[model samples]
Target: DTAVSQTPKYLVTQMGNDKSIKCEQNLGHDTMYWYKQDSKKFLKIMFSYNNKELIINETVPNRFSPKSPDKAHLNLHINSLELGDSAVYFCASSQASGGHYGYTFGSGTRLTVV
Candidate 1:
């Protein structure tokens, strides 16, 4: 079974459109995160959810929203998509034990905005 899984592995849309990507994990982790990999391959944390509570990165725009229905699932929604938002989004899960436990990341969802 996959430790973490993300749906719609690829997304292509117009700049003004809205889209959402779903993610689920069977690892029974307490914390889940959404990360974005920019064109330059810089990875940045966009949002994090611990037990369904949200902790968003200050640098992320309001247009991006992350919702976790439970500790096992986290979904990302982007509204009024822009070209700058095009990037590979990754979903990851980690236990409360910190970095020593390491994290499992799902195959990323590549979004392209025209």
Candidate 2:
């Protein structure tokens, strides 16, 4: 069983189109994060929400947004998609306790713009 799951493992859209990726975690974690992996395989943190509160918001474009309906879910929405947006988006959940952190990651959603 997967601890974290993301829908539509693959996404393809045209430029200027809008798209959304959904993520959910079955583990009992309070913090969830969104990460983007570019073609070169460099991972960048996009957003992190903890216990229904916005904790960490990285330097991402305004076109990218994170929406969380609850603690276990965080979705990524992108507007006016461009060719440069093509990459793999990952959703992960982590737990922080006593200076120790444990993370569970989803399979990731691959977005391609053309």
Candidate 3:
């Protein structure tokens, strides 16, 4: 099985709707990250947490929230979705000690806001 997995690989919803993407990692890592990739393939870090604690929250909109129920799972929820929210969201995990290597990534979730 994949070390990291994300459900709802593809999501299509209308504007002003709310949706969520779930992610889980069985790598026994301590850190997890949420990333977004735009049409031009520009990847941006949206949120990150270590040991289920919020670590880094880039300048993402308030509508985007990341929740970690435990060290092994992290989920992204978006409210009042807009067309600009269309993008590929990726989930990743790594060791918190080094915080720089051995990252296992999930097959990404493509979200489209129509």
Models 1 onward score TM values of: 0.94, 0.95, 0.97
lDDT of each: 0.91, 0.92, 0.94
- What residue runs in model 1 are displaced by over 4 Å at the alpha carbon? none
Worst 10 residues of 1 by lDDT: 53-62
**Tens-digit lDDT track for model 1 on 35-91?**
999989898888988989886564788899888888899999999999999999999
Best of the two (1, 3) by lDDT = 3
lDDT of 3 by residue, 1-114 (tens): 789999999999999999999999998999999999999999899999999999999999999999999999999999999999999999999987764586788999999999
Off by over 4 Å in 3: none
Model 2, span 1-114: residue lDDT tens: 789999989999999999999999989898999999998999899999997778899999999999999998999999999999999999999985544676688999999999
The alpha-carbon deviation from the true structure for residue 32 of candidate 2, after best TM-score superposition, in angstroms, is 0.2
Candidates in order: C-alpha RMSD to true structure: 1.2, 1.1, 0.9
- Using lDDT as the measure, name the better of candidate 2 and candidate 3: 3
State in Å the error of residue 23, model 3: 0.3
For model 2, the stretches where C-alpha displacement exceeds 4 angstroms are none
Which candidate should be chosen as best, given lDDT against the real structure? Answer: 3
Candidate number of the best TM-score = 3
